[model samples]
Target: MSATATADLISRAQSGDHDAFRALTAPHVRELQVHCYRMLGSLQDAEDALQDSLLTAWRGLDRFEGRASLRTWLYKITTNRCLNARRSAARRRAHEWDIPGVHPPDPTRLGEVVWLEPLPDALVAGGVDALPGPEAHYERVESISLAFVTALQLLPRRQLAVLILRDVLGFPAKETADMLDSSVESVTSALKRARASLDRQRLSNPDREPPPAPRSRSEQELLATFVRAYEAADLEAVVALLTDDVFISMPPMPYEYEGLDTVAEFCARIFRAGRRFELVPTRANGQPAFGTYLRTPDGTSNGVGLFVLTLAGDRISAMTRFEKGVLPWFALPRSLPARGGLPGSRP
Candidate 1:
């Protein structure tokens, strides 16, 4: 992981050693992908950008003269690629989620009321390579949560990068300025603007209180109950775990379902249709998650999507379901076995 070691690996990789290239870059890939996600807000886009950055780095390896650390060089390339991607025509197109045969929930139930993307908690929590400075000052998990990321999307791109590089990623002001190719003073100004914008936004959310730390006993208990209720297909039990004013949304689709009553109705309808769910536990944005699989009466298992739960106190405040294509990002299978012993499940 040292500069010399990286240089040697790069040399070997450039001389036709594929294994060397993998060895050199494998350790940083996961975290780098997460960085890409933060910049792009789309998992698919992040993966594509990461691949592009890697290829660019590989092809331009000869030009990389040790002026910066290999990690820093790759980061520069990756960040530039993501920023360029954000400016592309594709970014202007509104991304939509397609959930076959299901209507989107009403918008009244959404917490922050944004059409933001879903990210795996494991990806954010597990990938923390650039943790510079005091650990005490860094609330890494909280900073990367869905709530925080959505808020970040509201800021100007440069301010977003400044805040992330300085606060979330813990880079110093000087280093952040260097990365963004701005002066330290400009980085400071951008950070202030970003913070002010986020503060104004947060003030609008009446329920936006500082959440308790993750992995507390209460959080664990809540997640456990959710898993149990979901696995048993117990609609009522699931409703019991939700806050009275809970919100449910399936992104990439326009529907939003709000309140305990409405969410209960939605769940009841699905359950009444004899649709059973298999909840595979996972995490996203520092929140508990389940890779949701639907089982039809015929016993076929189909990949419904990913359900990422946001916990407030001991109750479930929000549930954001992402599309099936997101499964690969978390290393989940495209399809799973149905509960009723059916082969070739739709998933």
Candidate 2:
């Protein structure tokens, strides 16, 4: 709806017009959810925050003067809610790291936020409508990458908010200041800190190649090679698909393996463990991903993790393996049957 039409609807909704309110708010729901996901790093949390924000928006419509657009007003509510939720909560959830009795090498670094979750591409594929607003420094798709989101979690609450608002969402410092109920100087300072923190992470940054938009041809080929190489237990083949600077990090554990050789050697250990895996393709964080089921010594397959890939051209630049329990969030089955196609995957 045009701004004028949305304003008219907002006016009606303010006067107990529930239908008008829904109409006015529905258009922003997807973007708000994305915003919330960026803030909290978990889709479920984002939904909860967004739901609460919408209700709050409905009730507080009387206070929403015409000075700011409805989108901006709603974002302020959602961001604040996420901030509060983040402050009181443990961002990472603890889970068993490896197959029972089978441990990979000591992690390269212990990960801080273990509970990061994936956002499905279906929600992100704006298709013809997915253009970034003029101010967006990060591509809408790139902004949601697991690496980017994970890096985002490392920032202080205020810095994280500033970075997302100013860099990803393209909100100006003045607008961000008003949203946070702070001075523009404070917002600017926070953004600088956030950028510095993100730069320090050495993952996704302006220097890196822009992330492929969703599933580009190069990304798909890399993903296919990954599945084939992994399933076949071909170390050389697997190594061939990774970029020289490829990294593999298992979140919730800071142990990160950087560089192709380093990551390949680490993965080779898993292959040498006599474990076999089956890959079922899926999408997460607007990138190619797989449901990885490890075949145990018992000959039964078990859901181990959901591995997401970040691609640069035909090479896999980075990969992250999240908790196995996150599969259901992507509508993927929690467990897959064994190689025989029987339901062999145990939790």
lDDT of 1 by residue, 20-39 (tens): 98898888898898888777
User: Which regions of candidate 2 are displaced past 4 Å?
Assistant: 126-133, 204-214, 295-302, 336-347
lDDT of 2 by residue, 1-347 (tens): 77788778978998999999999988788888888888888887888888989999999999988798777888899899899989887665555565554556655566777767888777766421334456668866668878888888888999999899888888877888999999999998888888888778876545557555556676666677778788878999989888888878776555678777788788888878777787788988878888888766556567778888887766778888877877887777866654454433323
Please name the candidate that would achieve the greatest lDDT relative to the true structure. 2
Q: Model 1, residue 12: displacement in angstroms?
A: 5.3
When summed lDDT is taken over every stretch of 10 residues in candidate 2, the lowest stretch is 338-347
**TM-score of each model, paired residue for residue:** 0.79, 0.87
Model 2 lDDT, residue 142, Cα: 67
Candidate 1: C-alpha lDDT: 0.73
